[model samples]
Target: MTTSVPPADRRVPEAVHRRRWAILGVLMLSLLIVVLDNSILNVAIKTISTPAPTGLGATQSELEWAINAYTLVFAGLLFTAGLLGDRLGRKKVLLAGLAVFGIGSALAAESGSPVQLIVFRAVMGLGAAFVMPATLAVLMNVFERDEQPKAIGIWAGGVGLAIAIGPITGGILLDHFWWGSVFLINVPIVLLALVLMFWLVPDSRDPNPGRVDAVGVVLSVIGLVLLVYGIIKGGQLADFTDVKVLATIAAGLVVLAGFVVFEKRSDHPSIDVTYFKNKVFSAAIAAIALVFFALMGVTFFSVFYTQSVRGYSPLQTGLLMLPLAAAQIIFAPRARLVVDRFGNRATCTAGLLIIAAMLAAFAVLDTDTPIWLLEVIFFLMGTGMAHIMTPTSVVIMQALPREKAGSASALSNTFRQVGGALGIAVLGSVLSTAYRSGIEDKLSSVPAGLRHTAGESIEATLGVAAKLGPQGKALVGPANDAFLHAMHVTALCGAGVALVGAVVVAVFLPGRTPDAQEGKEEADLVPVAEH
Candidate 1:
């Protein structure tokens, strides 16, 4: 593989660098809005549940749908949207996505029913589909080869910042306004982003773009949606014999299998199967998926442990997550440097080991576990996240040609989202089953009245404890212990997954730096930004 350098004049041109940074700013702002929107709504769930017009009254799964619906649609459509960016102009599609996202946010804010909010959230996901890949495609086009790693690192950190601020922003909003205010928050930021894009960013597209494959889009969406639905519904699917869940999952696999066959045969495919032929791309995708798999597991149980088990308020729960965010902020830039010095394989393997160790640390938690120790674990998790998120994106985008950057980058994002969704579904199922069974075993010898109430919910049981005075509260202790034990067990399950992922990376990722191979393949393909 041969590596060619841009002419010194082209590499160092002041005007070109300024314009590239300007476009990066626009893409960063757009992504900030998208990432913030994802997590901001999380903290508002309680507010929406209590006093909002679209309150989730008595349906736990519907409550889950409020969050998972957007994720499901976002994950489902990403592949199509990425391919569309290749066929259509990235800038045109991205601007359109911004407008759609703004509209969806407004619709969600004004929604009067849970169903309407869920629908609008899905619409936002649709817009997100276009926005995400377009951002990277624009960056890949704009930045020179040598500059991309640092630029992508900064870009990844910006995403981390949005994640950090989301819950805090949601908390502050909830303190002052209705739950709808969270959705309203996106409108103004998006308008500002639109204005900046018009003034600063130039339009760019792939010159020899491929044809749009409508069939691939359909099969991909159907398959992913059904797969996510089955996993999410697993908790509520009565006795594992629920026909709807089984059928949807079965159909999803069939559709995806068909999609593979279709893509392989099609003259113009949306997802070019040949991209996976690159070892760097394949390994990077695996690493990215596993990172979120671990992260989503942490997110799911942390809230439950902090709130339901320890009786922390929503604000307190948000505060507890702060260390995780803070660690990312501190380590992300450093992670990029590490990757540069040690190469992807060494750096990524080390990082995954850190993550595995951190996940395992959570397995030892007990009612008497020290608060300081918990904070330390959260901090380590953030550091591990820095390693996982920062280098993986850079690796994946760098591995592909500029023309295929959007579709390649989309896979990175898609896997993480799908992994998170699956992690929550599967880990949630494990927690629910373990908690229920533990609660049942503990209540065997308790009075009949208490036994009946134990089957209700942890919240209901706690409420009952409050009413029955001190003695009643003592009876609630074992239930809390059982719940915490279940959480610890779930965390160990995550550690196991991370360990497996770490081993996979060590096995498959090339022992050498990937730049020489990448430089050869992309030699003829100019960046989209350069046009």
Candidate 2:
């Protein structure tokens, strides 16, 4: 006897099934723009901060704001944006997001001042907050259970692709065009996504949408913004003992604790706190965060190592980074097959361990280290990242109910952004402090005025060297050596963080047999009553 399929089981239509791949292409295209925006600004920072017709002459703090503005707004609003997508409709939210992002990009391209650029970047972040979660939510709705792992793998790989390509693309544009070209480049991509989404994507929303949790929204936004602000400030100061920094951080933590208490008591909560109770789900989140923490920290330092210390051109540095990107692209799609053959526990644990080893290897690097050896380490690091990222994302999504896809996606992406921000702040502080001390030790013979400039930063040191003629030539070697020393110190710390993350995964992440995972998926697929 044949069993009848319930209406809930029939939620996804045959047309959606046939067009699913096309839908994924459009979704990934949208994702690419958002992810690319995250890293593309890094290459353009120097160009934008230069004086006159070609640039804006932004101060160091203003330059930092230009970069941080986007991330801060993006992180602060992600959960709220996710909830809106779930309640209002994912496709509609995505379309609106694209339009807003496009507008923001155009305005940023025309920005006349650093303040204007920061404001425009924040607007783009608002748009990204809407676009990001909707992409994964739509993907979850369109793809069947069996196809999700592969699709998620491809989606995750887009992030790696963006990281690889953003610098190259930005470098090329900066070489031939104005600094604004970087922001303007996003316009065409956003427009293309908008048109395709309108034609191909279907609107999907939660059947039993909760009332807008105004209190929860306010609390989450305030808490996240304050927390990120404190972290950024703390990193900038590199002084945890500063009263202002301590007060800001303590305030943020207290408010976040209140947010948690409020969430638990709410009848119609914005996010279900119960998801964290699942060991696998929580472990997956932690792994993703820690991996990104290491990845971002390394990437930040490597850019300086390649460009400032080694003196590679932006385009050349981009080319040098190719191994990392290539490995991620190659391995990300294959991760699903590996997970199917092995298990999540083994795959994730091994990946983190490999990353830790690669990071430790980086700690020993010096000015004399072979370029090829660095490339090999990057390739291995990318491989480790792909293995961890794709599988963890798949497991996290699979563990969640379909109705919670928007929130879950936002939560995952939030962790990633937070980890990246913290990595840049914390690791950057470590690098800066070590480099400053080393530079001071070496600058004792230099003039006091020049010595201060040299100790300000590697860039400032190089600038001082350029002005000092023969004495400048003498300083270059010492400056590069100091920077390299700092890079090594930071790498050692990153390796320790990765090792700790591996231990967490080994202990908390569950091993899954194929039968067990299938059973869990079936259980998660139970039909809910239509609203």
Candidate 3:
């Protein structure tokens, strides 16, 4: 196999360089809104599942769709959007994405039904697809090679900022306004991001962009939709063995396999699969995927644990998550220091192991567990993630030529989203199945017609019980018990996934290289920001 050297390092243009930090602020604002919408929705899941007037009266399965819909569309279209950002101007695409995202947010805020909400969320996803990858691509273009790691750390920290802001904002809005207010909040932020983008951010693109790979894009979307749908379907039914579920999942795998073959032959592939040939690059990518895979699954359940089981208000639940966000904010930018000391393999491996331990700690939690203990777990998990994400992102982003930054960013994020989507699907299925089994016997006391629905989820059971007046009070205890049991099972599974990621990093990700060790000595003398 022939090896090719990476392109020469890019120099930041004098004009762009002068106001780089200002441009970063605009980029972060754009990104925060996209991430905020999702994190905000997590707190609203319980609210949206309530009957009409207060919410859209969505089922547990429907609620999952509401989330997975955005993730699915966003993940499927990310690569294409990245390629577009490369071919077209990044600034032009970024502006369009903000506009579309704003429009989608408005529609979502006014959605009268769950189906409308799901469709609108997908619309939001389309806009976000363009926004996310473009931000990193633009960052890559504007920052110097030596300074890239620090800038990316700040960028990753912005995700932590979004995580901190989203749920609290959603909670405050929910306390005062209708459920739709959570979505409406995005509009103002989107507007601000657009205005600033026009003023501050500069346009950049690949000099020699390729033709759009329409066929490959189509196959990827189809394959992902099919796979996720099957997993979700199995969860809803609590039966993975069903012919429909197995058939849908199998078809999805087949189509994805076909996608790989087709991309290999194409002159201008949307995703260059050959990048995986670099073991370090592949390991870094896999580390990102698994990190999100574990975290997303745990996050999916944590909201319910705090709000439904522990009986906290939306605001309190959001507050409880602060430690998690705080940890990320504190450690993300500083993670490079840890890498300098221990190398990527050690730092990332330790991070993943910390993540695994924290995930497993969920097994010890119950309704009466000390709230402070939960906070500690959240803080630790965030710390681990910060260290892993910053280093791995630097590795992945620097792997290719700077011109391919959009595609590189897209590839990194595509796996992250896909991992998160599958985490929700697979671990969600585990939770659903376990909850159903644990609650099945207790559900018999319900009206025969409602037994299946009551067994669907803790939320559905509680909603049904609320309708039963005084008779409904009896079901609350059983529902909480079943949910806790399911959570334990799911958390253990997430921990296992994290552990696997740690092993991957240990095996394939490199230790300290002589070049990096020398670079660290110089980086110590001059802070990255000064560059």
Candidate 4:
């Protein structure tokens, strides 16, 4: 066996090191901006409501689609984007992605209608598909094996920070400016990222990359979009009998199965199916998906609950989320150390359980529940999320060979994106169904006119109520109460799902040596021991 130096000793050349970290900063910033935009619009929902433009009226599915469309497209195209990055250059694809994302955001800000916003959001998602995987692959290139875990930890921490702070930042902007301000905010950040990337980021591509499978891309995208659509509408449609939903879901599955067959037969595959054979990689990917599934669900519900149920203003709702951001920031560095010491299995399970418990606790909350209680749950969720999120990427990438790092990272991210998409689709559907049913029941005794309005979405209810002044406000109290109850039910469902995820981790996570890539290096240093 050949002797291998430690990653520190095999450091990147000094000239490259300086330039590399600078590029890393730019890349991370761009990624942070992408993540931050995901939930920043949540708090702005109420702010966007005007007498005319209004909130999503009788369009709960449309609103959920608006929120999830970006993630859906992102998840659908991630593998394709990564392969493209390998075929072309990472920097080239990344810059192109930023430009597309910036243009999409500008269009979203200028959107005159809900359909316009949703379409632009999908455009943004398509751009993010390119940006996210390229960022991860580029980071893998920049950092050596021993350095990778730390670097990944930092990157994950940045993502958590972005998620935590996004709503609050959006709220602040919404309070000071128009609701469109949230979308407009992306322009400056993306511009800066584009400029810095051009100046500092180096370009690299695989010398002999495999062919791009256009058929696979088409199949995967169609399957994912249909799957997401089915899930988003599942609650409204009869779970068993809705032909549209059932057909769409069935079509998605068939397409996905076909896509798998195509990949197995293709001379050049988008994802190396062999990666799933590794126990560490598989477990890590599963954990990553579960964690994100819970994370997205909670974040989505929290903003709606805080602003809609608690009578908090958009800015107030954002301010309420401060503790979550604070906890993540404070515990980020320590979370990595804990993961390293305890190993991934224990730390990851603990984190998921904590999140599940927090979600369960939120379920029991009423509109009268104190802010202190909310803060406590938010803190636990944030800390737990920080712990859970940091190590999965490290473990997954470390489990793979160096040559496969780019593909592996892209696949892991695909799982994460899938989790987020499912969370929004599933949980949003549940919430919408419950909220609508509750409104119908609550408004049953009201005047026929108001009852018809109650049959509409909460957005329309709020809009009509707003025009009625104090009497209108009083009239809508029961509807608001019902909505809060529905939110509580949504929280319970999320908690149960998270608990299932916790069980998944405990049962499936392999108790293997940590940081296998580093372990491989260590093995190269010593002679083989006698059996």
lDDT winner among the candidates?
3
TM-score for each of the candidates = 0.82, 0.85, 0.91, 0.87
Instruction: List the candidate numbers ranked by lDDT, top first.
Output: 3, 2, 4, 1
> For model 2, how does the per-residue alpha-carbon lDDT over 19-131 read when each residue is reduced to its tens digit?
99999999889888887875677666655645657678653345656766787678767777767887889899999999999999999999999999989999998899888
Residue by residue across 1-531, what tens digits does model 4's lDDT show? 011112355556566566766767887898888888886976876555443443334256666677778887887787778778878898999999999999999999888777888999999998888888777767666666566655665665667678678887997887777777899999999999999988877776766656777787788888888888887767654153588888888988898888888888887776666677777677778777877787777777676667766778787887788777777677755765886567677888888889889888877777788889999998888888777765665566457664454566567677888887788778777777777777775554456776555544566566666666775676477666766776778878888887787777777664545477546743432111000
lDDT of each: 0.71, 0.76, 0.83, 0.73
Q: Which pairs in model 3 have colliding backbones? A: none
Worst 10 residues of 3 by lDDT: 522-531
Pick out the ten consecutive residues of candidate 4 with the lowest summed lDDT. 522-531
lDDT of 4 at 447: 63
Question: What TM-score number comes out for model 3?
Answer: 0.91
TM-score of 2: 0.85
Candidate 1 off by > 4 Å? 1-23, 46-55, 58-60, 83-88, 110-113, 140-151, 241-244, 277-280, 340-343, 393-404, 440-479, 512-531
- lDDT of each residue in 1-531, candidate 3, tens digit only: 000112446577899999888898898888889888988998898889888888888876788778888998898887778778878888999999999999999999999999999999999999999998788778767777666667766776677778998889888999899999998898988988899999889998877656888899899989988998898888888899999999999999999999999999998887889988888889998998888887678778898899889988888888888888899889877888888778888999999999999999999999999999999999999999888987886666445554444456567778888888888888888888889989989876689998888888888899889988899899999999999999999899899989988999999987765776547644432121100
Which residue runs of candidate 2 sit more than 4 Å off their true CA positions? 1-23, 45-65, 111-115, 139-157, 199-207, 340-342, 397-406, 441-456, 464-475, 512-531
